[model samples]
Target chain A: MNKTTKSNFITYGMVIAAYVIMQILVGTGSVSSLLKGLLVPLCIYVVLALSLNLTVGIMGELSLGHAGFMCVGAFSSAVFSVVTVDTITNVAVRFTLAIIIGAIVAAIFGIILGIPVLRLRGDYLAIVTLAFGEIVKNFINVVYLGIDKNGFHFSMKDSVSLNMEEGSKVIINGAQGITGTPKNATFTIGIVIILISLFVILNLINSRSGRAIMAIRDNRIAAESVGINITKYKLMAFTISASIAGVAGVLYAHNLSTLTALPKNFGYNMSIMILVFVVLGGIGNMRGSIIAAVLLTLLPELLRGLNDYRMLIYAIVLIVMMLFNWSPKAREFRDKYSLKRLFSKKNAQKEEA
Target chain B: MSFISYLINGISLGSIYALIALGYTMVYGIAKMLNFAHGDIIMIGGFTLFVVMNTLGLPPLVAVLIAIAICTALGVIIEKVAYKPLRQASPLAVLITAIGVSYLLQNVALLIFGANTKLFTSVVTVPAISLAEGQINISGETTVTIIASIIIMIGLMLFIKKSKAGQAMLAVSEDKGAAELMGINVNATITLTFAIGSALAAIAGALLCSAYPTLTPYTGAMPGIKAFVAAVFGGIGSIPGAFIGGILLGIIENLSKAYISSQMADAIVFAVLIVVLLVKPTGILGKKINEKV
Candidate 1:
């Protein structure tokens, strides 16, 4: 427990330090425009990685719908921003409201999807989560929403029949998606959100409920026999994880001027990418997740000069990282370089004695 | 008449899914790994055919043979290089590695082919089958797909039931250690399973591209995932279950698209899996294994 907390502190320190350095670079005009464009996305990915790790790493359920929650958040927040754009002239206030709405909407969805899904275990849970993502993606494509003097109207057929008055606006344009969203999301907001997520996740990881969640992950049957309410705990972790992903979604939505719920952007590939972050980061390691998300998010962009070879290199990195992390030789090397051995040599010798 | 056409379309599509699901079920049954890269092999096969026939100007049949050969060899190599070392690793680790292999295949394809859809010419040429006084017509590709799949299924069944190598596959899947003790050559059996699975993927890819008439880098992704769902729905390790599940899922998806909202078809198909699993967690033909604490 002490070690865990200490590691969390170290992680927090590293993240804050990196944030400070990045901010300094940006302020001094030392950063490139390409990197500046990546800042918000980098933060969003970090949050996604952290939240996904909560369920996959701590809760031990592989959810393939983290992006679905993000989808909910993105669309919801975008809609909120659009609806209130005329009334709320202040971008900051509207953006905050958008984030809050997005998080709540996503949490509700998480509960709705999680209740039935959490009943299953392992691979079954994974497939169900995958289905949930597909359902969300497909659902968005056919849905049309508009707001008029009579209030909000929705349809599945065509966006033209949203029943809005002449002065009213179409919020969701079916497959065309929500446009003219206020791009008020800045890099600083993203960093702050990332910090807030880290703080909540870290504190939760050290809390009693967090222990219960981990206990359930370690052994579901044993945890249930010991009187841990599996449903409540699983729901807690899953919902919180979903909400955080929603927060990331809000961040992402506001970063862009137009938000679309396209399969390419919010589908299996995106979900899998987030899962890759969690898995490659050493599931359950928050610091590692943050690092992996940041590094991997930057990698493709860094390799953009190579054009087509960027993704190829990314794929190679994925394979190599997996091998290094999981292979027996790598494990032996990790053991050799472990901080415990370096820091506690006297204790180790005493134990040997 | 339209209904019959839809049914034919669904059946043809389902057969392709079944072909792919067979490989998935076989690999899962024997290797006990998800082989997430299996779908990508379908893309590789299609791309190979496109290259051989379009670029190299080879005959369609010879192009298909080359594609099958490439996929089979690639599948064996993947198992040997990526999955072999991780046999003793945790399920999560192996799953991630499988995903990595999938990413590798996709990105490699993306780099080579770009993201644009490539038009693929139909390889099989047969007369359309008309029924009900021409009210219903099944395309030549659909007819050929259904018949070829049926023949393949029968041939695979016979091989598994009557062939020595097939028995070795069964034994290995049943108990790898025990199979090794019985001199079944477990690794060889696994390599053979991957080889056969990849070959099936090649056929499925050819039929799918010809039916759809467009091949993109990600053309196999949706089908791959849907096939995985079918594999699970039928019971992950059950051959007949995968077969039945694939056809049923295909029919359900198409019928839903025709009768209900076209947009909701994919969701409805997935919903069926969820409903089925809720009632029967191990799936339709899945055997219940006791959990060890």
Candidate 2:
């Protein structure tokens, strides 16, 4: 096998091995349950941050509504898992079906949203996506398919007919959130899914299509001159990124079991928080995004003991990180330890041998 | 009667949106970059007013002036720290940095203020005013919003039309490189632009807080997005267009919520934006220019 193929295999193998080891530890009761809970969310967020990096970092598109895609996945999977009684009989079947359904539903919404808005550039695209995100959240909150005596009935479809008199069924429960989702998401499952997502994205980034998308990000005009179809690639990035975000959403819903009643989690702030993770990790660097996502997610939990000052310390860290990058002294220090030379030295030694 | 009041309420709300949109349009006109944190500046202005009025026990007018002064300084600092260094960076870099600054300001506010709502009573209370139609009464607060917005709009127009600095601002907006060649301090001019934009945002915040006393750390996000929509709806860089667009958006949103379902109001507004963009990308009052090769 070629060296590149061998390295790719090794990376995948290592990731799978790490996941398996974590599972064994969790199963054996070696790791704390709190730590395990933290790992589940961290794994989901890594998928989210990395998926978002595909659009915002790699493709140079500013999509402010990624969480909306996640919402679609969460709701879709929640509804499907709740309705499907047979899948619960087998754990493997249930997991596979939920993921497949979540990814598919998210991809569909991604395409639907991407078609019109992807044509816009930069700030315009950002604003459009931001609006779309709000629209999705509100739509989910208000749109009721029917009313029944039992509760409110909600359908994923745009229109549904129901008898209005007996009792009202509000599908989304208005300000109230979806509840009673099957709690099948475990640390092992979350880690496996995250690893699979990372593998897919990494593979895509190294491929020719990925290069074309990155080229478009660097300079749309140049990429277009080189015969790249900008619209197609942008749509591709949006759809794929959105689908992965959907997977994260499904994992989140199942893990939490009870979704928050408030629209608090699906707002612009959440989107911005995810974007911060991407930026903090260093955009366009998958490893950076993964590390940043994990660290930032854990940082607050780690500092929970600090009580009122937890958020204060968190804000300080964020500000200091931004200021440090912008400071000239930091730049000089960064230049001294440039990774380019370090990697090049190893390559040169291998060539000499 | 309550529904009619809500209609009037929507119009007054739209005026505040118009006020904020002016700053967005003016900055975008000159810099060609959306000041993503413009809304947070408004939030800061509101908090400044709260501190001045509530904590310091200053009179409303004096407190407003203090708030404006602080916001103007904050605006200038933001421009210098976050934007000036990246003036020539790719649009994406500037955009990211703007978002960073936005988050920085928000988290700072959250850290300092806590997440609970803050009450600014000075802006919220006013006796109701009777209209000519005895059945149609208007709140004194709504009247103040309408009058204040008009006065501010006219004052800005006169300043842009007659003042030297305003003329220079217009020139810079027209052609930055050319204006610089003619001996304008582009950097200082840009700072002034941010300061003016921020001051207007402060006023809008103060007025909005009068109408709605509840202020949270995240209060700015939706208003900021709405103001941005107003800017885009009117024309990204058109000052007058932003004012008109903001009012129109406010009216449309309010009326739709009152006449139809409130839940669909957001969707309707976005649908309108999408249609406007498809029909006229440059916006209602914006001028279209061919992209440079």
Candidate 3:
């Protein structure tokens, strides 16, 4: 097999093996509920990191509004499930529909925001995306939505302004967020979504459009001179990345009984955390992003004993990880002992044997 | 009269934003990476001032000076430890490191100070200015912040235009390799930029807390972000641009809060940023650099 194919297989193998081992641990009751509960969030962060890598690593854009897209997806999907809870009696089917709704809505937001922002140059996209995220969060805070026998009611003032009938129900409670969100998200389903996301992201990275996208990232002017459509590829990568993040959002929303767009959950902190994962994992390396996400997400929980020091250690880890991934000496050492070297060495030994 | 009051308040807030944006613009100009930890420096400055003034019973001038010195030292140390090694790395890597430093400072502050909001005593003891038969009242902070920011802006412009070190900064930013060849110490220039920026943060923090009168661990985060938006609005590297952007942003935000919904004012400010960028991508005062093939 060719080098790229073999490496891709190894990436898949790593994920599947990890999943199997986790299942065995669960089967034997060796894993605590706290650790087990972190499983789905682990998948969510993994997906977020990978999708962000597509923008920051492959497309060569620093997007700081990823949490905004996630918020959009989470809210939209939760609303969908809430509206269709009685009509769509089947849990799996309803969840499938919700995921689709989330992905589409986030993709639309991505496209709308990306068009004008992407046309600009020199850090405009980054700052603009950050502003967009804040705007989304701010807008979500004042929004109040309710449903009555007649139809839907929306208001920006308060619940009293919704003017719902006697039998009406409020789907969204403004700053209180949506309650009664059915928690159907499970470890197995999250893993399936992660695998699907990996397949899509990895395949796209190795495809023709991916090459065009990377070319733009390498040298936008040169890529444009070579007849490549710069805006088209950028928009495509951004939209796909947003949709994948949206799927993660769907899982996130369903994992909780109530989904609120709190600053802690859907703020710049979350976006920066995902960026840290992407950077620490070695940008553009899909498998590395996953590994970094998994490790960093679990690090704080494992350090819960040192409650106050948890964030401090996490901060130190961020700095150390960046150095390990990007420092010159570290890069030299990593290059010298990269997986390709091991793979080639084994092939040479087999030939000799 | 109320409209006049809000305008005066807006200008006061804008001056503080201008001070913070100067830090962001200077750092971005020389180093070409957004120092995300800059906001935290503002927080540190406020806390230092708080501790010195309240806890130790130090006077205002001494507290301000101490805050500036401490912040300048901290900025230089952060650059040396967290950023210097990655000077040759990609911008993204440098940015992530800046973020790490920001979190480290925040977490450390939280550990030491706890989460309660500190009621900051205003260092500005100047009496309020009452206009239009007391229909409009402007505080001493308004007078001081506006005047101080203007003086600092003029001083910074002169320094950049005339000083040897400032010229060295311009040379390094224009072309680092050429600057090095011409015997300029690029590293020292960057360190100086960080020093100036952090010093500005301390001053801004003093003025900021005096105006707002409250301090928290995360106090700097939002205003830091807003000033960043201001910097970008003015053109990231242009000093005058940062000033104009800060003023305009403060005015718009204040007016929107008064006339429009208070909760949506943040959204309106951001929306204005988007519209402005769409019209002028390089920003109001940003010079367009041609790409060399």
C-alpha lDDT score of every prediction, in listed order:
0.88, 0.80, 0.91
Q: Which pairs, if any, clash in model 1? A: none
- Interface DockQ per candidate: 0.57, 0.40, 0.65
How well is each residue in A37-156 modelled by candidate 1, as lDDT tens digits? 999999999999999999999998888888899999999999999889889998788888999999999999999988888998876788788898888888898889998889999999
Candidate no. 3 TM-score: 0.94
Per-residue CA lDDT of model 2 for A44-136, tens digit only, reads 888899898988878888888888888888887876776564437776798679888999999999998788778788888888888877877
Ordered by TM-score, highest first, the candidates read 3, 1, 2
The candidate maximizing lDDT is 3
Ranking by DockQ: 3, 1, 2
Sorted on lDDT, best first, the list reads 3, 1, 2
- TM-score winner between 1 and 2, please give it: 1
User: Candidate 3, clashing residue pairs?
Assistant: none
- For model 3, how does the per-residue alpha-carbon lDDT over B1-293 read when each residue is reduced to its tens digit? 89989998898899999999999999998899899899999999999999999999999999999999999999999998888889888777777778789899999999899989999999998999988898999898999999999999999999999999999999988989999999999999999999999999999999999999899889898888889889989988999999999988888889999998899998998998899888887779998878797
Candidate 2 error regions (>4 Å): A1-14, A86-88, A145-171, A306-353, B1-7, B124-127
Where is model 1 more than 4 Å wrong at Cα?
A329-353
Better of 1 and 2 by lDDT: 1
Instruction: Report how far off residue B234 is in candidate 2 (Å).
Output: 0.6
Q: Which of candidates 1 and 3 is the stronger one according to TM-score? A: 3
